[model samples]
Target: MKGWKNPILLVLGIGVSNIGNWIYFVAINLLVLKLTGSAAAIAGLFIIRPLAILFTNTWAGSVIDRVNKRRLMVYIDILRGILIAIIPFFNSIVPIYIIMFLTNIAGAFFGPTSETYITKLVPPEKRKRFNSIFSFATSGAMLVGPSVSGVLIMYGSINTSIYINAVTFFFCALAIFFLPDVDEKLSSEKVRERITMKTIAEDWKAVISFGKTATGFMIIFLMFQFITLISFSLDSQEVTFIQQVIGLSEKNYGLLVSLTGAGYVAGSLAVSALANRLSIRMLLGMGSFLSVTGYLMFYLASPQTIPLAVVGFIIIGFFSPFSFTGYATFFQNNVPVDLMGRFSSSFAFFQAMVQILLTLLLGYIAEVVTLQTVTVAFSAIGLLLAAALMSLIFLQSKKALFILEAENNLTEEG
Candidate 1:
């Protein structure tokens, strides 16, 4: 806590970028909807994103593990700024899709690389608290961004909103420039020893070997990721379910989405303020349990009692901070700095793979079955999965904790 200025400033920078990302997200969806007038185009975004991540993460991890992560972060942000700026100029839908896909490739690398930088910046003991703060910042953006984008599109202009998003990325890059770069938490000699001439395949083999030694931790991590994957299905089908199934108008549905965001913001702030007091286990346990409850609440709601749907979504949003707080702590505390890049990206890659398959499968299911039926059915699956996830986290994690500690000790002593 002695010199917290830099990390706090960095968090502010991240918050700006997070808000901008969400703004662009909403704006682009509206843009596409206007251009093509097709719900399918909006859904195509989910497909385009994970596909980009799948291809990029296959090799991004290996490069991230070897490179200077700070410099990588700088370059990616600058390029992202450029990419967002380019989007406004494209008149054709095809060009927009291509640019969006390229932008995603940059984002895929930026995700784990920034995480690696944070590991080197924040100490292990404070990571849970830090994660809580960071998660709160992002949730706040999720709360604000879409509403702002709507106002901009309605009153101002979509082009103006896109330019604002572009500017935020440039500001983010500028803010990150001030933070001093620490290549690794390890000593210079240790980092030098880690640097190798290995090919991508060999670096991945190293990653595979490390994963084998702590299979239990990896399993826990993947379960958390899988839970997240199932949660995303709601986002993809939300509009259709609300309009077609529940018979809400477009404006009313937007209000419901805003309400969900409000619930999320409140939940995030609650955990952020109490992060110092809550243990990681408590966060994860409560989060996992409530997520299932939220899913079931919405699933079980009668079409006439749609307010219950609001309550359900709010419950899910409120628990967002706690689950992510536990997840970030679990990763930062357990994973060694030397292998953090590959480990995090490998997890991302696996998560992306599941998301791709699930998104496709769930989309197909929604088309065949009624959207409402698919929503509730998937919620049933999420409920069971959440129960299993909670059990794994709470019931049988002693051995996993020991393995993680052993691995951490080895990295530190190396």
Candidate 2:
């Protein structure tokens, strides 16, 4: 609590930036739809996001540890703000897609950089609480952002909504500008290391070596990556699923999304309120189970019960605090702050690679097969994956218990 100045400001900036993102998230798709009238184009944007990450994340992580996080964030925010602002003026699809892709490339730098900054600023003891609060604030923004965007589009224009998003990004930059520097010890050698393909490869090699030494950490990391990979794959098709199969309008889709955001807020607040009593196992394992179950429900949803999608989304949203916040704390506690950037960004690189391949494949599949069938198949597969992950967690726990018991016995004999 004493040295919370940096973390607080950082979280504030993150929340502001997230609000802007959610605000424009749907609007951007609608903009593309208006231009091309192709759901495939919308899904194509999802692919672009991961492709940008794959192109940037490895080098971004390698260099992040050598740089000033605050300055980097501010610069990227300004760049993204400018890019987003100009997006409204672009009448051609090619220019719009290019701008969006570049904006995401800039954003790739911000995400890992911000995560590493938070790890440095926030104390391990308070990390979980801070993340819960951060997530809660972000979710609050999610609840209101799309609604605001929708209303602005209804009363004003999509261009106006996009401009609002642009403003928020600048606001975020301003907010972060005042934060005291939160950084780790930057190596002289690191500053000299230029960004290159070799740099990424070397960093990944180091990450692999580090993970090998800590089997438990490696397992948890893989779990996180796999879950995200599965989720993002579905995300590429989610909007299409909502509109076509579920028979919902754009406004109703936003409404149901807001409901899920409300659930996220509730879940985060509950975790924050009960931080003292909750154990990581209960939070991570049980949380995964519940979140996955909610996803399963959505995957199995029918048009007759389309209205019930909100309930499933809410349930999934409700448990995110446990899975996301728990993993954040887990990583902070286990990984070195010096290597945090590399560990995070390298993992993201892998996740992006997985998402890129899977999203393209799934997108192709969705074109030929019914979108609903694809949705349910993937959702059902996600459920099975969750079950397998839980088994891994169970085995890891048993292994730890056995090691602890052996240690105790050895101590007693001595």
Candidate 3:
């Protein structure tokens, strides 16, 4: 318990912020709809996030690595809080979109900075357990956040939920403020490098060089990211598939989402309890394979087989946390903290580009082809990727990469 103090606080802060984000998501959508009465406007909101990532991540890593991450995180949180707080005052959709994009830019910075900070704060041996706990916190927030937002909107107004989200950001900032500055010992002189185009170009080259040298790690990382993107594309079309193709009512669709959230909560609990017993190899391999299988099942189910779809949702919701915990721990363990920001941001830039293109392509294809056909094809692709991921995970040559500590190699071989 004594050793868990910082991790606990960190998880709490993250959990709070996640809940606020969900609340803001619901409120902002409602606010937009109320203002413009356009579903397309809400859809446009989705595009802003990746666009913000593309705009910021190209150079965000250079700043992330050169600054004190903890202080940077605190400042970003405060900035986001201020931005979100003022969103309700805007009656125009364009201004709201602009502000949302800026807020997302701050969020883009917060992610890698926090990841680097977590690596610095948590020891290698404890990272698996810490990440499992973090997943549970995230799952809880997913379940509670929208429900809380719904109640607030019912009792008060959308502005109330938005303001509450801003409050949560401030709360998160306060929580992060108490955390130790892990980079305090590093000389200020070492971190004061100028952020010229030459420096940024050199950083990109270094990240690419690292990827070339660490092919195994890059393969696993990119594969998992592709799988996630497929899932996202499917999710973007979920409502239409459920309502139009499956002939389900909106009420039933909401029920299905709730059940999926319940499954996530259950899975997070299981991961937290079994963190000590499960190996990273098993977590990554089995978790990804099983989760993709669930997606495949969901994609194949028809109106007459709603139960099958329900089961699929449960399986995916339950198992995804396992994959997430494994991958996050693996990333932190393998990547040198000094280079993590650059590696994460650089790949994230490429990912944003791919995401925008893939999402638009899928949406276009779904209109031309049947949604069923498009979904089935992409999910099948995910299945293949999962198999490839599992093969990579189980390879004997890569066993050393997953070990939590240098001395723990003996345990993973079994």
Candidate 4:
């Protein structure tokens, strides 16, 4: 029971976790389209949250390592819920943007802290299983949330959907209360003990001092983020294309997005089962290949063949979290426990930066070109980048082999 309790709590949290978020996503986009009717404004709104995440993540991570992570999550949940609840009450776009920004700020803390907390609770050997379960729960929430919101919107309007989303957040906050206490090492004391500008400088020096592998990993993480942002930023436009060009009904289009969630569930299960037998690097490469292929198909393939598009999107769905899990595992395995929070935060920050750039770039491209062409170009670039990265990783591993052997020899001697 003790072993099961944490996962259950985490899943419950995931259950309602994205409810408000997805609702806001669909509703707000519709709202933006209805209001100003500007494609660029819609794109800006789509990209802004990630941009917000990019700016706050590093500072949030640094703070998380120094504070209680569980508490951070709880507070973040409450704050976000409150902000979401306020959305329906406002008629002006200005307040909506403000709330969105605030929600993104809270999100920066909520996501990384949740990861840090989970890492602390789940043992390394079972990380794959834990991650799988967590993914499933979030996927479930995402699956159900939008469906529920759609029904609510049918009965009432966008405002009613926002209200329902707020209810989901309220429940999420309650679920957070059930999470058990988690112990985390605070880095502040260590910094305080050596409190000096020179000491801070030395610590920064140590971070990059580890040489190219560490630095290179961070860079790869950023690249992967860019690819993901490119994929995600096109989601709204894809739905539009399906409805406008492909002549699909809204119900059918929703099903396509839902398939992506289903793919995520399947992919998470596969990764969890194979984590022991498979090398993380192989999975990482495979997942990247899948994403690049999936997006390329969507961009270039003829929408006249609806079945092909469905299959292509399922592939995208399948690989979505496969690549993310690789990134998560990389960070978990490499980062020291004490610096997990800060490092996770820094990773999130880098991710946010990638998102911002992708959003802006995609936004600009959408102005001149079709969304399909943009997706194809973005995906092709991702695939090419992934291939290059795999080659670099192979070379890095060979070089590091001798150093690893030497270290092993020293340990044996002692």
TM-score of each: 0.90, 0.86, 0.96, 0.80
Write candidate 4's Cα lDDT for 226-325 as tens digits. 6666676665468766776567899898788878788877877777676666555665667777866876676565657887778878898787666666
Best by TM-score: 3
For this target, which candidate reaches the highest lDDT against the unseen true structure?
A: 3
Give the Å shift of residue 394 in candidate 3: 0.9
Q: Tens digit of lDDT per residue, candidate 3, span 89-196?
A: 989999999999999999999999999999999887688888899999999998899999999999999999999999999999999999889989867775877899
lDDT of 2 at 33: 97
For residues 53-140, could you state the per-residue lDDT of candidate 1 as single tens digits?
Answer: 8888877877777677877888888998998898888877899999889989998998898888898887666676788889889988
Candidate 3, residue 122: how far the Cα is off, in Å: 0.8
How well does candidate 1 score on lDDT at residue 286? 70
Q: In each prediction, how many residue pairs overlap at the backbone (N, C-alpha, C within less than 3 A)?
A: 0, 0, 0, 0
Model 4, 41: alpha-carbon shift in Å?
5.3
Q: Model 2 over residues 293-391: C-alpha lDDT tens digits?
A: 777677667789975677788898899888777677666666777788888887787787877788777888889898877777777777777677666
Best to worst by TM-score, what's the order? 3, 1, 2, 4
Off by over 4 Å in 4: 30-44, 184-213, 233-252, 272-277, 303-306, 363-374, 391-414
- Worst ten-residue run, lDDT, model 3? 405-414
Clash total of candidate 4: 0
